[model samples]
Target: MYPEPMSKSLEGKLVVAISSRALFDFEEENKVFEDSDDRAYMDLQLSRLDVPAKPGVAYPLVKKLLAFNTETDNRVAVVILSRNDPVSGLRVFRSAQEANLQLERGVFTRGRNPYPYLTSLGANLFLSAKEEDVRAALNAGFAAARVYPDSAVAADRHPDEIRIAFDGDAVLFSDEAERIYAARGLEAFQAHEIERAAIPLPPGPFKPLLEALKPLQAQPAGAPMRVRTALVTARSAPAHERAIRTLMAWNIQVDEAMFLGGLEKADFLREFEPDFFFDDQTGYCDTAARVGPTGHVVSGVKNEVGGPRPSDR
Candidate 1:
């Protein structure tokens, strides 16, 4: 066996923080809480304590990510940070064990929000089923998303290849152009993009996570499937130049870039069939979730606490 590395500070490791619901199917239990009460929900969860929870939308993506840790030097950590009380947490641990997920750390905050502990975990990404918690995580300066439970499970094509897709603005780049579009519409946003074609948008929360993947991408060719990435943005034609140029300026090369303007991403994503997809808008997130593993990046101006819903626009 290879000697494992031990790092107290998580140095040289990619840490992911996720909620129990995002990693496992909790719709039935959540419905119990909504239809009756928390006490009743706890009772149900307790009764089924030994039963392993079914995998949720993020399961395939997490499984592929954990595969990269097959070597001792390559480190990837996933922690369960959930609002589930300690009593209900017994099932969560049992489920992870049944799934063979090497999760050893978690924070059970009961009814309290758990976003505050994300920093302590040195998390590069946070995924949960709760929109409020995701927004809180983003506001706290972490790459976070709200996973949709109804998303289809990922296809295991190219078992060795791990492909991930990301939205350009808001999710990867700052919400700069998104703010303009929200205020003055698409025409203005396009003109602004043309004007700043040479200027690279500032990095968004996920930039760190993307940068972290660089080392993994550099692995030897003989290694089992490597990581492949794509940028699927809603910007087309003139506006697309800025996003392309920005990535060039950053010296990062994505395997593919789809510039779909005002088109429903669900069908397009259905064809691409990525392990996961992340977007800031709820409409896209909700739609894509039905096709495959998806995460709702909740950052940018549109998600402001008091702002109107993006679907209203």
Candidate 2:
């Protein structure tokens, strides 16, 4: 029932919008303590217990996108934050104000401090949030939002030009192998992929998304999806067969694939100039952000301490 994939030419050209959770600091209410218990609940909610701690953990994904505004010359990004700021929050208001000041110096970052702008930030895209985060935001009286631009709208936005880039494993495929590499070791993961390379790999996590883009893909190259899809991943040749096969079996045509084999990907990305780049790994996102508009789709895992999770931590 989904729409077809977008055309090759209309891949990554469009306004890209991202989100943040802190826009301004909340004014702490004075409390007449009837008992110590009253302070306990208040502290948990308002987080007034820690002066240095922020109101909300600034989602590293947001920072990654913000970093894009600094480097990549293509695609505009608008960052949205919650109006109810958290003390431990990522200083969303300060960042916005500062980014505003830098704007005169030619810094072109966009800040959506007053949450309402999210729906109309020229891109109309919201980010993916964990179920718990979405619920908590709503439960705590914050607005529940989701990324807009279903395939049709995305196609319409760039009907004549789009350049999409996908990060191999997690962003395009399931994280199963990625989990294996993390849990068991590269040797074991590589062995598993070699064993099943001929069996035909399952559709990726975003396969449906690719299928939905088929319609857009069908149009003439000059009309949409100007470039065929590109897959960028850390997997090398022998370990990358399944990824290629899976796309082939799905009848998905990828214009390019770069197996980094531990090399830094930013250099290659700069040449590609993708309007939007998606990757599940923070390492790739960090570097790619310097080259283009990047989106780090949040997995359900709450290892979210803010910034890239330390590999050792």
Each model's TM-score, in the order given? Answer: 0.92, 0.50
* C-alpha lDDT of candidate 1 relative to the true structure: 0.85
Estimate the TM-score for candidate 1. 0.92
- C-alpha RMSD of candidate 1: 3.4
Best by lDDT: 1
Candidate 2 Cα deviation (angstroms), residue 64: 22
Of candidate 1, the 10-residue stretch with the lowest lDDT total is 304-313
Top TM-score hit? 1
Query: Per-residue alpha-carbon lDDT of model 1 for 1-313, expressed as tens digits?
Result: 9888865776678888899899899999999988998788889999999999999877877777788887456578888999988889899999999999878888999879999999888898899999999888888989988988888885476588778899988889998898888888888989999999999999887888888778778778987758889898889989999898888888888888899887888888888888889988888888888888898888888777797455422
Candidate lDDT values, in order: 0.85, 0.47
Q: How high is the lDDT of residue 284 in model 1?
A: 87
